[model samples]
Target: MKSLFLAILLLTLYGCDNSQNQSKPPVKSENKEQLISPYFGFLNQQKDSLIALPMDQAMESPEKYNYVIIENQVSPLGFIQNKSDNKESNGRQTAQNFANSEGSLFTIKNEIKSGDFGMLVNQAFLSQYKIEPFTKVERETTPEVKEKLEKKYKRKISKSTTVAVLKDQAEFNLTVFENQQDSALAVFSYIKEDQLINLDFPATYDDISTWRVDDGGQFDNEAFQVLTVLRSEAGISFVSIFWGAEGYELNFYQPKKDKFTSAAQAYGYSSPL
Candidate 1:
């Protein structure tokens, strides 16, 4: 009887160990590569040239394109690479020059020369990457909802500010700070079924010095503007543009499992003066 009791106790302990191991979450692999959506790309126009703002790893063969162009209402025009030096600065300068120019709209050319750089775009390269447009619904806040948000966020809601709701059901509330500065910052809040799920900027500068230098104390004037919404293979994404005194920044926000997060961002056009 003593030996049988000891055996049963050992088996019970082993079963408990197996159950604990099964209940614990699996270890995530460190070697896994981050996934990027194929539909992700920035749109900007310069004169007759449709520019795709340079984004990191935005293309499979980013080496081949000196420029990325968009024609008509298409999402991605194509990839163009400057064969001269294959330098990013050259590409940016080429884009900036086109952006600064003024001209009528035109179609994408296989090859074009802007400033000192000559770029070639492969029309077939981005054929697989396509995005569908998302609807932007403008909504007004009710008195009760406004008061609830103001009290919860500890910031006064702006009556004049517009609330934009994307097709994915994410809401953006642009609120003005009540301090003397009265900075016009966006309170990115999302409501699902009339319940606030998330509230915060899609992205923010980590360093105060970076914010000061990049924004140039233009917080009061800067506001979030919806550039476009895209539906890609990865999921739905919203692109927003913020123009400060120093330059303009584009932020891509996408829905994750439960909340929206910043996927990528690109800076463009600081005053040469």
Candidate 2:
């Protein structure tokens, strides 16, 4: 009887100890590096290298990458002529001159020869790393949100508004308001938990040239629109495109030290009307 009691007590103690160990939190791997998305890495590489490769390289070696930028949908930066020069010639002439310029990375011959200038990505890289894609949330602007924005900007909001949520960690709100001149001005704000932050555009109103005129001959309002949102385990990137009299501007914003700040910029010339 004494031996049986001792055995039962030992069994109970072992069970309790095993249960406690299982309930403990997982042990994170030491010095585990965060994963960056392949697409984001590719963009960063291009920006850093500043070396444009011929479009035929991807085609000559199709097995080298899973995806290749066959055509440049957006105008490559640094190829467009000065905005001042644009006024001297017709739009078609300016476009033709731009195409023929030696400095231009994209040319009519390149387009005809090999689609367009672009980069290629390897399938193995994508399979090794996983990144979340941005999902578009409803455009419904809540009264609380609207009130917060109105109070912050001290302006009446227009119906042109959009909201996007990223990785369930960040919320973005783009709102437009009419300035004193009755032109559309975009205001971008970010929300995380109880924090509300606004993005200060790097370019001032004075720096931007509004050359496009409306039917009424008034300067066209710039439409600052979000182009893409990329998420990686390391960080989140917000890419936006807007136009001015000069051409299209691409701005890259990323969160750093608790605020979304402009990290990089690219420019593309608009095809003249």
Best by lDDT: 1
Q: All models: lDDT?
A: 0.46, 0.45
- Model 2: CA > 4 A from native: 1-132, 136-138, 167-170, 178-185, 201-222, 232-235, 244-246, 256-259
Worst 10 residues of 1 by lDDT: 112-121
Task: For model 2, name the residue pairs that clash.
Answer: none
Q: How far is candidate 2 from the true structure (C-alpha RMSD, Å)?
A: 12.6
Please give the distance, in angstroms, between residue 161's alpha carbon in candidate 1 and its true position after superposition. Answer: 1.7
Which residue pairs in candidate 1 have backbone atoms (N, alpha carbon, C) closer than 3 angstroms, thus clashing?
65-80, 65-81, 66-80, 66-81, 66-82, 67-80
RMSD of each: 12.6, 12.6
* Candidate 2 C-alpha lDDT tens digits along 33-83: 332222211121122111122221122322233332222222222222212
